[model samples]
Target: MKTIQRIKNVILLLAIITLTISCNSDDNGGTIIDPEPTTISKYVVGFQAFPVGQASPAEYILDLPSLESLTTGEISVEGQGIPLRGWRFFHSAGNTVFTAGYSDDDKCIAYQLDENGALTEKANFAFQSTLDNYAALDDDTLLAVELTYGGLSDKRFHFINAKTGLLEKIVEHPIDIDMGSGTVEDPGSIPWVTGMILRDNKLFVSYHKWLADGSYITPDVDRAYVAIFQYPEMELEKIIEDDRTSPIGVNGHSTGIEKTENGDIYSFSTSALSAGFTAASKPSGILRINNGATEFDTNYFFNVEEATNGGKLFWMDYVGNGKAIARIIVDDNIGAWGVFKEQGEFFKLVVIDLINKEIKDVSGIPIHANRYTSPMFVEDGKVYLSARTGPAIGNNGENADLGETHVYIVDTETATATKGAKVLGLALKGVFKISN
Candidate 1:
């Protein structure tokens, strides 16, 4: 019996030793396991930087804690941030941010936050032509369009899965309109797609008739045209025209058309010479299409140029509550082609009440030049956009002193603006909020 008790005591001591080892293994360097890192969400700012001696500008995307925090200091992309292949346009849907290479590279890359709270490339896709226009059909899908210069070839539309960064489908449609008597090299007048939106199972595409000879000559400037198509099916329904205003939208700018919160679609027409129009036959104005309707409302027309006393609408985006934030060129003598060439500061930020057809200038923002600006980021009745204080490009095609570029925060209700973060680059291409 004593021998049996001795054996039992030895077993109990062994069990205690095992328990002590298991509990102190981490301190003793025995296969320690680390906790998983937590992922974070951040706001991203795309900056176009021109190094002092470089011939071309570099594109950089940097993640920030908040846009408002950039108000005091200058933000630069010098040893930090992700550099893109070339100059690109930025758009965000859901948690992913899409960047499309404009000229040299015909690729689109989607970026999202990683576990380290850094912006990382999520997916990459390529296209034959530059994506001129894009719209988010839903949180998961993005619709992009590519149109050739002369509109002689078939226009291609891409439906992409925004979440997966995959091209789901491609729809092609031929240009059936009479493009005048001209060869493929120089079609006298071709349809130039400016903006597109999807609403109520239908898609509306706004365009202008422009010359193909690189003259920026808008041939038919007295009519507003919108092509209506069946959404999801991608079938053409009809092309509606309104003679009340010039062609809807401008080249390289997507603010030519937008949809409001109440389901009403509004089209902006800038028949001003500064807005890539070689001629101004009709005054700049706004046209509307009622909810669930494909045709322009016959009784509704907002003569914006007349209302603002000759202020031409340069760009606009809808804010909620029947209002829109717009950039208006107040100078009547801004020479033709100067706006696109970045000649002077003629753009003034304003808030327009679409319901009352009234305009109020936003205080605190100086007259600025908008050679190339991204779509405004609108959230909770506030709009955020990059407002550069100087010209983006000099007259000699060299990098000019692009004064300070700041993210301007505009209050839709008060019609006031407060300068936000200062960019240490040539310009701030876009600002976005993305998640990992």
Candidate 2:
């Protein structure tokens, strides 16, 4: 009796399989097969997994897909985590993404995206010490500025091979800014290197010398300064200055300036609430250099605050076709370490017309307190951004609850932003998209 029952159950299982296949076979005399995905796009975000607004365990990288079917996945370097904390800088070229630790580690890592959209460790480079400002020179090279605080002396720029993550060259530049000695009233000047541009076989590095005090004050508040160094030789050509704005770019981070489609360069200055950043010294705005010219366009000046009714320019990046997207601080009266400030509110996105010298506010971006945002990424003529509010959007938004971090997909033409994939991390260090 037991043998008969076992045989009967096996027969029933086979019959059910046969019936299911038959149902899928020729419904309405046509065959149905699932389609295959052709291309893959992703937003690679570095997750600083921590609480209390800072500090982290070993960091993780997540490759969140644009398509819904393929779930978001993490990129582990040989099954090991990448060591990143606080702010991170990234540069994307070819099918690879390059990352260097800022305000922290001395390591550089590259993740290569294959045809099937798998990010594997390509190389990991180490510096003699940690680096501050970062730039991508070309397909095979990356530039990192190792900065020291006081008066910008003995600063070094290391060029690394992107493929192998090895140091190829070094440019040692001594920045000469007259900063007072560290006393109660006069703290010396520190070279706050902001960003770099490579053109005409030379490197144009933008930075400002600021007081070493925690107030974040700029000592030389009269002119915008750019250090010109001949590439490969690393010889100082000349320091160019214009009495146009306070500083060429903001104090920290790298996206304060960029080259546009027409080979023209435009830079934005923060000129926020500080001793030298007052309106008499400089109002935050746009300044440009004509293509192949070393001097700032003397005839061109676009005062962003004057045009936008007192909105200070926080950051600007060239999106495509001579246009840029910027973040503005309207009425944020937070402190220097606003990263810990939870109640302050006022940050928005906008679009800038470089050719026409116009600034217009962008719509669809929510307002919340954001102490800082990372460098932006542009791919396929679209600007990918993280509306970085940390966790303050929760308490400040209409919902009045803790909020999560997300990236914004901006339509540059329309000046409207659409929400992208939800990022998993404390700080939205940056977003990069690798394409085939």
Candidate 3:
């Protein structure tokens, strides 16, 4: 009996030891699980603009929610009363948020975003312009445009200082091109209002050459160049032109430019040669201008017929680690998104690889085609494309909701777009930028 009792005690001790070891192993091993991913916030603003003779309206402000807590399928616009319009940021202000808009009458409104995401109205100066697009310089000044009725005569640009509310018209020539010098076949009109960016004290303004039909041709003209000016003095520095062609391999036109964090200007144009306007919906290509030499980077080129061209590259918002978030027209011939085939009817947001210069279709996001304006990055490593959310019209009589704009914050970091929110019509055009 004594021997048996001793044996039982030994067994019990062994069992307890084994159980303790197992518990310890399970606790330590289970706690070594992976951590959740992190992302950066993307700031965005709606380019809300209306045509002339139309009732002017105010743009809305929106706050994009994180991919983790997206329940309502949309982000919230924290500020309800703030209004904005055709505006651009100033890299000199450390990329501070500065914008200008038009109020009823001839006044141009200026605003700055405080650290708290609140817009402080800085200046309200009277501006007379039939067409205008404004770009902020540092935190003090902006450049915009003014044109006569029907935009047939002299169209001028104004340089307005945010501090003193002073407006100065800057037009070296009454018009961008010499109307009488050459027998211009098809003159594409400059966009209603043109914009300018100041870099190294040089202002680069995009010039639009109108076509003969009065309808502004897609951006892809070699004659189209970025006019460089000396700020404050507004002296002509140089007109930077690129090698571009027209839609259907016809006339050339170039439009949008984005300065990368790496100090390179990535210029994009609508091309006639690469993809005919009607087929690809418009001309498309991205030209890299560096060292005073402009070369069309094949990787960034969008050839509509080519499998990679997607459809046509419209706008490039920013350059990421190795790619860019842009709005590109994808052909419905491939049955993408079952979207409409009409030009501008079925636009899709795309993420283009800057290194390889290849574009990947990201049109799976649930939103209207060609609706997103500013595609920005968010804190969660997600791409946020602005969506038009409302029905057709805003009570304001302005072309209110283009397509029920909403925030499609996609996390391609995970190879998926996880966060999205749909706001009503007015909320679609709301102002949205990342905080925290």
Give the top-scoring candidate (TM-score). Answer: 1
Residue-pair clashes per prediction, in order, are: 1, 1, 52
Q: Give the distance in Å from residue 216's predicted Cα in candidate 3 to where it truly belongs.
A: 4.5
Give the per-residue lDDT digits (tens) of candidate 3, residues 1-436: 9999999999999999998778766965634556764433434344343323454433543233334323255343344435445332211122223343333445554444445545455455654543345455555655556543233455566666655555645664433443432345533344332345556666666655544344444333443356766766766666655445322111111125655556555655544222223323333565554433333343444343253745555456554565676655444343322332111234556676654667666645643443323324344456655544323243344444345545566554433453355544332332334322
lDDT of 1 by residue, 1-436 (tens): 9999999999999999998788778576576778887767687877888654645678888888875555556778888888888778877778888888888789988888877777788898899999878777788987788856654566788888888877888898754455556775556666778888889989898888767654556777788999988877889999999998899887667667889877899989888786678778788899999998889999999999888533788888888789988888766466776576432577888898988899999999998866676777776667888777764456575446646677788897998898887777767777777777
Distance from true position, residue 214, model 3, in Å? 5.5
lDDT of 2 by residue, 35-71 (tens): 8866766667655543443333335666655633112
Instruction: Give candidate 3 regions above 4 Å deviation.
Output: 1-58, 61-105, 112-120, 147-155, 162-175, 181-195, 211-224, 230-232, 247-255, 271-283, 291-309, 331-345, 370-381, 389-404, 412-415, 426-436
TM-score of each: 0.86, 0.77, 0.60
- Best-fitting candidate, measured by lDDT? 1
Q: Which of 2 and 3 is ahead in lDDT?
A: 2
Cα lDDT listed for each candidate: 0.79, 0.66, 0.46
Sorted on lDDT, best first, the list reads 1, 2, 3
